[model samples]
Target: MSHDNKTAAYFGARDLPDVIDYVGEFGAELVTFLPFVYWLYRAGQLGDRKVSTYRGMRPLYFFLSDDQLIEKDEPRRFVGYQKRTDPSIWGFIPNPNELIATRNAYEAFPNYRKQFQSTRFSFDKPLLVVHNKFNREWNSDTPVNFFSIDQLEQMFSRLKGYYQIVYLRHGRSGSVDGYSPDHNSLIDFDETSVMQRHPEVIDFEQHHREYGGGVAINQYKNELYAACHHFISVQGGGAHQCALFSGSLLLILHKRGPEAVHAYSNGFYQYATNPAPVCMIAFNDRQLQDGLGAFTDASLCQGRVMLGANGSRIANDLAPSRVQRKGQPVFGTDRTPEPGDVGVHF
Candidate 1:
């Protein structure tokens, strides 16, 4: 939690510590668990360089070696991906503390800042961010877009009531319903009876299916937090920071295997009795939304804003231009996390 002189800093690296103590340093607690499947896709995308570093575990000297010379060494493709970079811009070296502060500061901007209006916090509130690490099924070759009908149903049903939900679709839009241009919102993922059931949910697709849809979604949340409540997500890290800084309660929903259900549940929910009003919502149920109400109920009882001023700090420090560019490759293609890498396996 303390980054005295011993800590080394760099630019363009994503190897922040798994657990970040935000209380003393920033008054919030944020944790990150590596997503094994996501790492594999990222690694596989890097192709040949896949063997060098595991999920950005070690410092990526390649950026320093090339000095933004990514375009010159066009790497091979893994499922239509090629590693390339833009030299004009300097990549960021992420320090856990710096990133946290950066995220906090970023969210503090006027055009964007919110959540600090006194109405968001309760007397004894503990904002907790759970970092859920999940593993990938090595043999199962299912594209991110194509979730089994059962999986799709569970995913949607499990995320109810939570204010903000983020799903990282690593390209390849060939799933239960092929990635169609018009399909963007969660409702788009639902088909037949599922779609019919949520008739009132507006389909924010036409504008959301662009090149940097995810980035746009985050940006949108930055503005939306002024009025909304909490931001909950399965994907942790920066997204979680965004939520916390926005003055919304950070609900970390981790994905553990079915067998790990008891562990996951206890790990999160047990924190409810802590001095701070922080709560963890862990689940093995494919239907993640099942526990949405619990999170909302906890947030209400705690009377805490979902995000805070620190989130605004991050919004500023790590501006989109400073981090990885949209539609560009940051690492090699090897989506699976390597041996020493930390990740969640559910």
Candidate 2:
């Protein structure tokens, strides 16, 4: 820590989502004349001080929006990353007790809650995204975050003509209620199958190049999400990222109750500062059954959709009334409502 004047000390790494969160902090730095700001880079994702690695940091400086960077000094540093605690510039850190967290560490940062998105990736076809997150066998303590392949297929069948059900493949696997994503089956996405590509799916690198490049992978990922019309996923990281960056309507399924979700501060707005519309579907009992709950502010309830598990109508039936109210569309009426595709905060 004593010798190198060039290398800056970045705190968070290992987790890709959190790392991207740190990258978002760079925006606050760019707008201000703070001389120099600490750049966060994961352990192997950077280079030695002697060698200025242009490739890794190039995309960031190139693609960042005017609002993303806080007015600060201009110097690139490759600080190391770790997985213990995340600290935002303004100090809005997460409660140490929760095991799973999003950009909560960067919550206090100025641009921390803002969504950095690009529209170049959106398709002309109606888009629907499914971000499945199931717990691995060893990690069964948490509830399942994925849907059965058959369930997904059913969803596709209903939405095929109206919407393209896009499945996200991060080369992951897990089980739920004796069911898991199948490698042999054409529908599942595993490490091996991930390489085999699909016509309907959107891959990050390929799409980025199509849009004229010059951006980091995380920025590209946000671009991919930004292009979509709606996102449906269990309550987890994918849902969190989608809410923050994708600009898609969120349709989330959460198993945890209001008490636990409240205690953990799992609202989507805590992470996504975007003033976009949001609506969450809770699967817990004893909650308000038919009423709606808005994330961020209650007045921004135009497209505010919320329904309890037991007595609520299916998302489709409620879309018209839930998504639009008093002649106003939540995020505009450019896209149609695909139930199971809603929004979140936290």
Which candidate has the top score in lDDT? 2
After superposing candidate 2 on the true structure, give the runs of residues whose Cα lies further than 4 Å from its correct spot.
1-119, 134-138, 141-143, 172-216, 255-260, 263-266, 282-346
Give per-residue CA lDDT, model 1, range 1-346, as digits (tens): 2222222331112333222111111111122111111232344422222222112121211222232112211221112011111111111112222212222111112212332232321223233222222212323432221333454345445443333333333222333221111112222333446535544222223224543245343333233333334444453332334333433444343431121222122322222112222323333333234334344444343444332344333223322222221232212342432222323232
Candidate whose TM-score is highest = 2
lDDT of each: 0.28, 0.36
TM-score of 1: 0.35
Tell me model 1's lDDT, rounded to 2 decimals: 0.28
Tell me model 2's lDDT, rounded to 2 decimals. 0.36
**Residues 272-328, model 2: lDDT tens digits:** 334432444544221112212211112112322333432134333323222221222
lDDT of 1 at 220: 37
Candidate 2 has what TM-score? 0.44
